[model samples]
Target: MSKNKAKKEATEKEYRKPLIKRRKPNRSIAGDIALYLFLTLVAFVMAFPIIYAVSSALKPLDELFKFPPTIFAQHPTTDNFSDLFITMGKSWVTFSRYLFNTVFITAVGTAGHLIIASMGAFVLAKYEFPGAQGFFKVVTVAMMFTGYATAIPNYIILNKLGWIDTYWAIIIPAFASPMGFFLMKQFMEGLPTSLIEAAKIDGANEWKVFSGIVMPNVKPAWMTLIIFSVQALWNNKASTYIYSEERKTLVYALQQIQAGGIARTGQGAAVLVVVMIVPIIIFVFSESQILETMASSGLKD
Candidate 1:
C-alpha cells in the first residue's frame, strides 16, 4: 500500500508546473534601434584617439603637415616605423639598452607590487591584529594623494638611502603603492571566512591557505592590479631620480626624438603608438576579469 502511494505521488510530482512563469521583457523596435545607435556612438568616441594614433603613425611627412589634417592616411606607409628604428640605432646608447631598462624596471616593480600588496591585503582581510585597522586607514589616506604630491618626499628618502640613480629608486616606491592594497583588500572582504576556516581545519598552514585558497579566488583583483602597476612603471621616466643616460627609460629616449623640432615628427607619432601598445594589449586580455571583479567587489556574505 505504501509503495503504491509513493509511486502515485512521484507520478503526480513529475507533471507539476512551475508556480511563476518567466516573462520576456516587452520589446520596442524604435527604442532598441535608438539604444544601439547610442552605444555605437559612445564606442566610436572612446576608440577615436587610438584610431587616430595609428593613422598618424602611418602618415607621410607631407600628409602629416597638411593644412587640413586628415584622420586617416590616404597613402599609408611604414616609413615612419623604419625611420624610428634608424633614429634609435643612431642614439648614443643602444635602443635595446633603454628598452631593457624599461622592461626590467617595469617587470620587477609590477611583480613586487603584486606580491607585497596581495600579502598585505590577505593579512588585513583574513586576520585581526593590533593596529590593523589603523594601518589600513593610513593606506586609504595614502591612496588619496597622487605621485606628484609625494615626489619630493620620495626623492629625499631615496637620496638619503643612496638609491638615487639606481633602479631601486623607482621599483621600491612602486612596491609601496597603496592602490593595489586597497583594491585587493576590498575584493577579498567578499570571500567567506568559513571557506578559509575549512582549509585550516584540514590542517593547511597559513601559507598554504593563502597560496592554495585565497590567491586563487582573488584572480580579478590581482589581474587588474597588474594592469595599473604595469602602466605606471612602464611609462615612468624617472628623470629626477636617475640622471644617467644609460639608466633612463624608453619613454625618456623617445621623448628626445619627439623634441627634435619637426624633423622626427613621423617617428614621434610611431613612438606614441609603440608606447600605447603594451598596456592596451594587457587590458584587452584581462578586461572580462576586471569587469567581474568590479561588479562583485562590494558583495559579501
Candidate 2:
C-alpha cells in the first residue's frame, strides 16, 4: 500500500510540471501584448501633429478654414510654395540664400561640438590631473543654467567683436556647450581603461591614443552629440537672429508668411511644412542607427 501511494504522488507531480510551464508562457504573452498596445498608442500621439501639418500645408485656400477642420485636403495646390519665391513678379533671391546660411551654420556648429566635446570628455575621463573633479563639477552646475540667461551677454560680446548680423553671431556662440561635454565625459568613463593603456604601451601619443582607440569605441556617443547639436542649432531662436531683420533663419522666414494677414494662411502653413521636413527627415534616418549602436555597445560592455 505504501509503495502504491508513492507511485501515485510521483504521477501527480509529473502532471503539475506541465501546468506550471503553461502558466509562465501565458503570462509572458499577456505582458508582450500589453507593451505593444502601449507603444502603439504613444506612436499615434507623436505622429498626429506631423500628419496634420502636412495635410494643412496641402489644403486648398477654400478648405483651410473649414469649421470642423478637414483631416484630408479636397484640393491640394503648389501655389503657396510658388508664392514664397515670387515677390511682385521678381523672385526674392534671399530665400535660398538664407536657407543655405542656416545649413552652413548648423553643419559647422555640429562638427565643432563633436570634436571639441569628445576631446574634452576623453581628457576628463582618462587623465588624473589635479582639480579635474572640481572642474567637472563646475561643468555640471553650468549645464543647469539655461542658455537664454546668457543671451544678453553673448549679444554684447558679439557686438564688441562686430559679429552681429554675420554667421559668426550664430556659430561662434554655439561652440561652447557644457551638455555635450558632460555627455561625452560620462560615455568615456564607461570605456575600458585597458584599451587606452595598450595604445600608450605601443608608444602612441595622447592624441594618437584618443583618435585611434577612444574615439572609435565611442561612436554611439559621437552620433548622439551630432543629433543633439543639429536639433539645437536647427531650433535656435533667442540670439541676435531674433533682433536682426535682414539675417533671418528659416524659422523667422516662416513667421513673415503670416505678416500678410488671414488671406495668406495657406501660404504660412506651406512655409512651415517646408521648413519642418528637413529636420524630420534627418531625425528619422539617424535615430534608429544611433539607438541600435548604443544598445549594442551597452550589451557588449
Candidate maximizing TM-score: 1
In the order shown, the candidates' Cα RMSDs to the true structure are: 5.4, 7.5
lDDT, candidate 2, residue 119? 87
- How many clashes does the backbone of model 1 have? 0
lDDT of 2 by residue, 1-301 (tens): 9999999999999999999888777567679899999999999899888877788788877788898998877788776777766741242537766576677888999898898888888999899899898888888878879988987897898889988878778877777788777778877887899999999999999999999999999887877777777778876653454456445666666666667688778778787787778777776777865674455333111
lDDT at 142, model 2: 86
Q: Residues 1-301, candidate 1, lDDT per residue (tens digit)?
A: 9999999998777655332222434556788899999999999999998998899999999999997889999999999999998889888998889999999999999999988899989989989999999898888888777989988988999999999999999999999888888888888888999999999999999999999999999999988889989999989988998999999999999999999978888999999998989999999999998886676544232
> In model 1, how large is the Cα lDDT of residue 269?
90
RMSD of candidate 2 to the truth, in angstroms, is 7.5
